[model samples]
Target chain A: MNGLLIAIKSETFIALRTFASKLIVAAPALVAAAQLLLVRLTEAGQQARDSLLGGSNFEADVANNAYGFFVDSLSTGLTMLGLLLVAQAAYSYSYERDIGSIRHILIRRVSRRSLLSAKLIHLHVLALLSVLLLLVSSYLLSGMLWEYSAIVEDGFELISESEIREEITLGIQLALLPLPAAIAFGLLISVSAQSATQAVSTALGITLAIDIFKGLLGGSGPLSLCEFPAFPDRPVLFTIRQSHSARLFRCIDR
Target chain B: MQALSVTGLNKKYGSFAVLDDLNLQIDKGSIHGLVGLNGSGKTTTIECILGLQEFNSGSITALGYPPPQLHLSKGRLVAIFDSPSLHPNLTVRQCLEHALLLCEKPKRSTEDVETLLGISRFRDFKIKNLSLGNKRRASIAQALLGDPEFIVLDEPFNGLDAEGVDDVLELIRTLNRDQGTTFLLCSHQLPYLEQICSHIAILHKGKISHSDTINNLLGNTQTILQLKTAETEAASKVLETISGAELIDIDTDGYLNIRISGADSIAINQAMVENKIPVAELILKRASLAGLFREITSEDA
Candidate 1:
């Protein structure tokens, strides 16, 4: 409908001009890059110490794999991204309502439903951009610091490169599968809340509370907390499953 | 044709009634003022009309669309609220540009509206940094970008200075005159309403207690003529003899107040002169919107 398009244009206009949207897009990548840098620095120091002692170990070999570091960086970045997106989603609508700016669009060119749909679409676009940037920065930094190869132990292959790539693909799919639900929940909270501050605090509080509660209940099979190691096999799988329940919970919310 | 019509409107919050069987109609191309007390459901009525909230029961048609479908009008309807409805982080120009995205068919450029609102200099000012008055001017300027057929303004004069008020009033008058734009202004500013509104509706006790043309509504109330005379007794006697003239009060300052209906100053002065009552100072206080509003509200209270 024409009204829906106008609403989307209005949403896009504000998102392009405001700093909040940019913050959401760039902050995750920046944090992930810093994390990769810190890890690489620490690993280099440990390697220097090992050479001084005239010794090396298996832990060093496993830690030197770019895939593991890449997955770790993604885990940290995605966890932060999830929280940031929820908070931003909560803040977006309620803040506009607090300032009374949303009323004009409602009265002039669009219905409430269209305005909501436009916000949902806008936030998703921001999420996608943020994720893309996070992926590039984390992938590049991890590759620079560590070698991209199969996990090898004494000439016998523990894990092949093809297997690692497939697992990473599956990990990313699983982690991202629940994001739409998370964003929807944030919007629901935003609309339900009385103020921007209330909406942000409540949404984040609920997310953290669920994370803690899930961790305490002894999550079934793989690691469940995206923030914590949920799976023992792959760093990639742990991060993927950590976000799974929340995404599932988000669908229920939707 | 009517620009707005509400019939059998009933709205309640829990057990308390806000609008009870309310009905109102606004003729097209007329500037109507909606005046009411605090918590008297003025803004509530507006929210219902704009479809921002669901009414308990009623039918509201604004510009021929139901409240829920007002958006189908596509920029033909606009509303400016008491608070400046703008993104605090955006500069005035950016905000106007953002608003332009919603205007399906814009009639004026951003610069023209900024100039009209006297906010050209503040075009680069962020909404958060601008003074309340400037912010309001910018808000008004955004509304002017589209040639809206119907505009609803709630407390439009809240943050305006005297000069700003004059500019807005002039702007409203011009738009109504030139473009035949219909306006529903809800404000506590009675004097400005009197100056600009063609019609007035007084909401009281959850209903439209009074609604009519400015002249017709004010005309129903009595006009007080205060005269300080040399012969107070003769002046009282002269007024008693005149039809539709009742001596209401005599102040300690030796001024006599008479409430007269269906009589002009000429007739009152002629009667006094014929009786040889010496009139030194005379002030005719015609019924005003403020006075009538006060009278009606106080009576209801």
Candidate 2:
């Protein structure tokens, strides 16, 4: 851990000035916000057509709940964040090595292990910031587009807003929990790969390939890709789906 | 005390050995040069010393620290690579600033180094945008951010204009003379290295075949006298009688190629005259850095 602080400061200095760090922090939120806006616009057009045709929507209340939309947005944003973090983590070290900048730090003020650890910490900080921003934007956008209310029928509440909030919080926690491990895997690839392009492509390709193939294994199979600690997005995907389905079922019960 | 030392170093790629029991020593305040032909393991040696590439077996200590723990030196040692190892996205000013952050006690400001390296106009330019020479300057600028006690440079003069070469040479001279900085410069530019380096290590095959002070090593090299004559047999006979002259070979044309070690060329010429060997032509060729390197490496082969 020698020169860890200096390495971190160097990392932070570059991250602050470079495009990659900013992309990691802002891209997920931007993508999620766009998705939410597009969904809202499409819903508005559908409602306009419904009114013109004089047809009534029966499941409108459930669809209009902000909590469900918020949960959905979190899922999409986290998915993007997960993939982005892995790709970025893979790129960071290998790119520096490719450019030969890492040699200076190694020779002057940082050990190899310290350099790697500093990168890990720096990427984690970036991932955390991205998740926070995504959460805030998603929450704000969903609230703006939909009502914050409990699922109710005949003036009797079937599911309380507080209960829905608890489920969404749990879902968010489970979905976001595997990100650090995913980033570590990306870093391992970064260290092992020869070039930045190879590192990034291998990291994302292996991660996504594993995720895609793991579905063929399915739950209760010998090789559960969803349960793989390194590839945690599958469980996260399941959590997002479960959250949405729970809210949908509450509305059906009402 | 030595500023850097490598002992019994061995490096290999698959079965081919790049370095075999290689040893080098750079004394404090001396500009040491590592000169060899291409693919003669100059870069490999540098990389092994800096911990950029691992050696199979050896011990390397720089500034009282092993290669793996070189960071413990904390800005006291630095290196400038052959390639411009700067952040391409960062402007020259920003790259310098980032390097400055790593310095424990900054001696020169980024502006100071920028102006010193004559890269002030390109300060705002990204490293990727700067020409190779300017990028090299910026890379050198970063190494000068602190008052490093030791500096290692690999192929330092590559892609530089004549002026750039002069500037870098002068910079190395000044640093060693004024600051008592130790240097380990690796390059094939023997004449430039001969101009600046106090000591030269000739890496041949996989080991240091010859290493000493530049004066001593060149002093030990044999001078050649290409003796053209009407009588090659007579010249050969006369050269055999000389104490320090050895007839190494006879060329296609009737000429006696002789090596004079610890002996004067005049003595051989005088011997030929006394023996009545008609010397048609006599050319004196003194051994040089290039000559010695070529001789030693050619011998190794």
Q: Which candidate leads the pack in TM-score?
A: 1
Q: What is the DockQ (computed on Cα atoms) for candidate 2?
A: 0.78
The residue-by-residue lDDT of candidate 2 on B1-301, one tens digit each, is: 9999999999999999999999998899999999988998999999988888988998999988988888889889999999999989999999999999999899999999988899999999988898999999999999999999999999999999999999999999999999999999999889899999999998988999888999999998788889898888877888778888899999888667888886687888888888888888998888789998888878757
In model 1, which runs have C-alpha deviations exceeding 4 angstroms? A219-254
DockQ metric for all predictions: 0.73, 0.78
Tens-place lDDT digits, model 1, residues B1-301 = 9999999788999989999888899999999999999999999999999988788998999999998888888889899888898899999999999989888889999999999999999889999999999999999999999989998999999889999999999999999999999999999999999999999999998899999999999889889999889899888888888898889989999889989887777899988888888789889998999999999999946
**Cα shift from native, residue A180, model 2 (Å):** 0.8
For model 2 chain B, give the 10-residue run with minimal summed lDDT. Answer: B254-263
- TM of chain B, each: 0.96, 0.87
Q: lDDT score, residue B75, model 1?
A: 81
Taking all chains together, the TM-score of candidate 1 against the true structure is: 0.93
The 10-residue segment with the lowest total lDDT in model 1 chain B: B257-266
Candidate 1 CAPRI-style tier: medium
